[model samples]
Target: MDYEFGMLAWSMAGHDKDKLYVIIKTEGEYVYLSDGRLKPVERPKKKKWKHIQVRKTIPEELCSLTEETIKNEEIRKVIRRFSNV
Candidate 1:
């Protein structure tokens, strides 16, 4: 699957398994993810593409964010809205 920015994904390995995260950036075989709380947008967690199960839902607001404009609060809101957490 082609990973893109703003896409939601679930961590499938490690301690973060089943936790929701957003795809902030992608590089080669790795993707930067943020849950908006523990792993905020400012400091995204880098994991392999195979480690995250991509979700079909993409937050339209996030798609317009640039690196400089991405905010942790907004990311959190999006996750909470979708995951109902």
Candidate 2:
């Protein structure tokens, strides 16, 4: 499955198993993920495609953020807020 930017996904393997994360970037079989906490935007987690379970894709406008506008605090807040809903 093709994963879009800002898509929600769950870790299926490794030490961070079962943790929720947002897809920040993707390339080939790897994807850059951030839970906004453990995996902040500046230090995203690199996981394999087959190791994640995609939950759903949030609205593009809501998740779509330019590199210049992407802040760590905002990313944390958004992930926390949406997950709590």
Top TM-score prediction, candidate number: 1
Query: Candidate 1 residues 17-48, lDDT tens each?
Result: 99888889999999999988999888899999
Q: What is the clash count of model 2?
A: 0
Q: How close is candidate 2 to the true structure, as a TM-score?
A: 0.80
Global lDDT for candidate 1?
0.88
In candidate 1, stretches whose alpha carbon ends up further than 4 angstroms from where it belongs are: none
All models: lDDT?
0.88, 0.78
**Residue 8 CA error for candidate 1 (Å)?**
0.3
Off by over 4 Å in 2: 59-61
Q: TM-score for all predictions?
A: 0.89, 0.80
Error (Å) of candidate 2 at residue 67 is 4.2
